[model samples]
Target: MQVNLHDAKTNLSRYVEQALDGDEVVIARAGKPLVKLVPVDSTPRRRQLGFMRNQGIATADVKGDFIDDINAMFS
Candidate 1:
């Protein structure tokens, strides 16, 4: 659906709802296309608790200061 700038501004909500319904809406200025409205993927991510609990170890369990060695290389 193509609409003029003024019409897009006036009926913004209606056009947006159309876009959300998987329709492409084009805003025009003097018969030239300026913008296309489309829906954004707003899917939520699922999070897992203790997903890799056994894959990690406590910092105190490390025998040496690993970061100190890397810093020494840059210095």
Candidate 2:
């Protein structure tokens, strides 16, 4: 579905919902295609926080016993 610049601006939310529903949306300027609207990847990536552990690299536990000392310094 193609829409002119003015109509795209006026009904931006409706077009966004259409795009999210897997519709191909195109914005045009002077009858020329300008841009497309698509949904972003919503999957959260898992991080390897302690990748270097057990490999001789020492790591600190930020939420461990040292948390009390850290709070005391701030107070």
Candidates in order, TM-scores: namely: 0.60, 0.64
| Reference-based lDDT, residue 57, model 2 | 52
Name model 2 segments beyond 4 Å from true: 58-75
Query: lDDT, candidate 2, residue 72?
Result: 92
lDDT string, candidate 1, 1-75, tens digits: 999999999999999999999899999999999999988878987899888989987767333656787778789
* Deviation from truth (RMSD, Å), model 1: 8.4
| Candidate 2 lDDT trough over 10 residues, lowest sum | 57-66
Can you give the lDDT of residue 24 in candidate 1? 93
Query: Which pairs of residues have clashing backbones in candidate 2?
Result: none
Evaluate residue 46 in candidate 2 and report its C-alpha lDDT on the 0 to 100 scale: 90
